[model samples]
Target: MAAEAIDRAMGALIGGALGDALGMPTQLLSPTRIAELYGHVEDFVAPSADHPVSKGLPAGAITDDTEQALLLGRILVSSGDRFDHARWVNALLDWERDVKARGSYDLLGPSTKRAIDAINDGVPPEQAGSSGDTNGAAMRIAPVGIMMPPEPLDALVAKAAEACRATHNTSIAIASAAAVAAAVSSGVAGSDWRVASDRAVAAARRGATLGHWVTGGDIAARIAWAQKLVRGKAEKEAIRLIVDLIGTGVASQESVPAAFAVLEVAQGDAWRAAVISANLGGDTDTIGAIAAGMAGACSGLSCLPQGRIARLKGIDLAEVRALAADLVAARNAKAGSGKEAAA
Candidate 1:
């Protein structure tokens, strides 16, 4: 209720899980199909016939969204700013071996795979992630925000870009991942949604080689047009239009822009906004998670439904809360000692 930074991290993780499970049932449901069936689901929806992958995997169990995020959290906790890339690759391999369906090492992007391979061949961790622009980077980036809080988010975002380069190094991918990471960090650090959005956009603008015309203005236009289409229309329809008009992929432009549209438009609301994002059909879980995480980060834990809180998996709420607390503690310790160097 206090809207603390740790609270924001917890809320974002919970919201990300909720969005994944809530959308899992209707993951591929088209806007038109969703309208014909249950409209505007504010709760978990049962899996239907013709849905793709894990059609009956029980409601409330999060997919790769939470799993990958938690893995990243674990990495940060173990390594701090000196993240070991090769070690992370081994950890990922182990996680995949245990495969709870959250994510898989085999599901990695080309850039990440290349980076890890290079690291195994003796490439440095600092240079390992310099070649990726995949959503793979942004997908697991929220934990970084929780790990480093109450600072100018841009600094943390740069680190996120470095981490992502283990798989994607394109400027667009770097910029997009940086935006999501910055938004989460800013949100946890007690910034408003507008301010978080502004901070995120600023970070993206400054870090990206693309100018406003290529990145900012275009993204704003895409979201604005989507808002008009979805206005007064059911949320499902809006999702289809956005996905149809803009595509969803691991690529920075495709996935990042679509995710950004939902965040930019649905700033103050996380649940209603997640529904809009989930209905996009393709990459529903990741899209919903990204939008929900961004919004949840800004809105703080108070914005999440208690019903969702009762249904977390993989790790307990207590552990998650502790991780959140540790981030603030780490931040305070570093700030107090003047050791809060850039990552």
Candidate 2:
């Protein structure tokens, strides 16, 4: 069980990075532009010189999606399930500063950046993220799923919301994050993709009732819709429908649902899910990261290609492994305590 826990956690984390790296070059490009340039990004590829955010990045280099997730994982392990809003804010600032110091254009997402700026301008952290309605919350929430179990799902949703409160506190954003976290948690608990998807939908509904209300398509409904939308379709048709109807934008409603659709299209194959998401254009990296994280959790590390995993750059695999191990330990400790208390 311990070994399996570590494997699933590693799968979630590594899968997210793999997807982020695979989609780096294609992130902001349109599907048409992506087709013109790379003709379906099955492997890691360097961004073109004209690429807006990821230009000059080497192939297999992860972007902010994976970086932020690693950051969150580190925080979760260090803090031991106690979310520190101030520490989180400081970490984001430090991360952005480091990115700038490294001369990288990749930085915080719109919602995160705005919330940070607002906080800097004296807005309270809790209220600062009221305007956030993007996928920024969901993109970096895999760690929460790793540290928490899916049973007693309200606890999981609340924890996910706490993580989102500093940046993505809107209904849609929290719902999106909760959905991803629940799926990952369920998968870590050894649930199949079907069970994970069901947990995700339920968690999204619960999460929607929290956070500042925002007007957007229902995340739960959209996820169910997306899964059904992609069912039994050809890969090309599914991808087209995802890009055209489900969307791949930064909006939580769009990208999160699109990720679920991509997962369905790939049939829970982490690598295939990442590849499909990478070619979907728009916020490809984020969509890929979220989809692949869930897929990896369901399938475990064995499903990923070792050669491609070896090609990944700019992340410490040792630290990621340690974090995963530590999170699983923490999860076990919590479960033991809960059972003891119940007895």
Candidate 3:
């Protein structure tokens, strides 16, 4: 059971990076543009020369989605069960500096950049993220899910909220992050994909009551609607419906639900989910990362293509595996103690 937990944890981490790398070249492009330029993102492909954020990045390089996730994972493992908001903010700032120094245009997302700027200008960390409603929180929340358990779901939602407090404290943002985190947690606990998706919706509902309220579509409702919308549709048709109606932008309402929709279309196949999300256009890397993370968590590392996994570059897989092991150990410790773990 310990080994299986570690495998799923590693799957969540590696699947997120794989999806991020696969979507690096397609992010920010329109579906038509992706179709015209790359046909369909079946594997890692270098970003087009004029690509705004990821231009000049190599084929198998991960973007901020995976980088920030790994950063959060490291923090979770080292900090034990407590989530340090200041440490998270400082880490993000340091990460952005590194990204700039590397000459990569893929810097911080809007929500994170805004919150960090506000923090620098003397705004409280909790207040700084009150207006953020993007998918930044959800995109990087896989680590929280990995370290936390799914039952006593209120605890899971609260942990997710704490993780989002530094940069994405809006109701929509918290709910979105909680949804993804719950799905990942459920998957790590060996739940099936459908059960995980149901938990995601439940968590989203609970999470929506916390954080500053913002005007947006309900994340939980949209996730349910998205799954139903794509149930019996062909892959191409499902992708088109998700792109046109469900949307594929940075909004938590759009991207988070869109990810679940993609997961449904792929039937929880990690590699296929990543490929579909890569060709999904608009916030592709984030959508891919979220979808693939949940899928991998449900299906484990075995669901991934080993050849493509071997081709991945830049990110440290050994460290990811270590973090997974640590997180699983932490979970086990909490379970053995029969006590609630701190977030």
lDDT of 1 by residue, 225-255 (tens): 4435545544445566577777765556666
Q: What are the Cα lDDT values of the candidates?
A: 0.65, 0.93, 0.91
Ranking by TM-score: 2, 3, 1
Residue 248 C-alpha lDDT in model 3? 96
Q: What is the TM-score of each candidate against the true structure?
A: 0.81, 0.99, 0.97
Q: Per the 3 Å backbone cut-off, how many clashing residue pairs does candidate 2 have?
A: 0
- Minimum summed lDDT over a 10-residue window in model 1 is located at 210-219
RMSD of each: 4.5, 0.8, 1.9
> Ranking under lDDT, best-scoring first?
2, 3, 1
lDDT of 2 by residue, 1-343 (tens): 9999889999999999999999999998999999999987889999999898998999999989999998998787777757888889999999999999998999999999999999999999999999999999999999999889897899899999999998999999999999999999999999988899999999999999999999989999999999999999999999999999999988898999999999999999999999999999999999999999999999888778889999999988898999999988988887787788889
List the candidate 1 regions with Cα displacement exceeding 4 Å.
1-3, 28-40, 48-51, 100-131, 209-240, 313-315, 337-343
Model 3 CA deviation exceeding 4 Å by range: 339-343
**TM match of model 3 to true structure:** 0.97
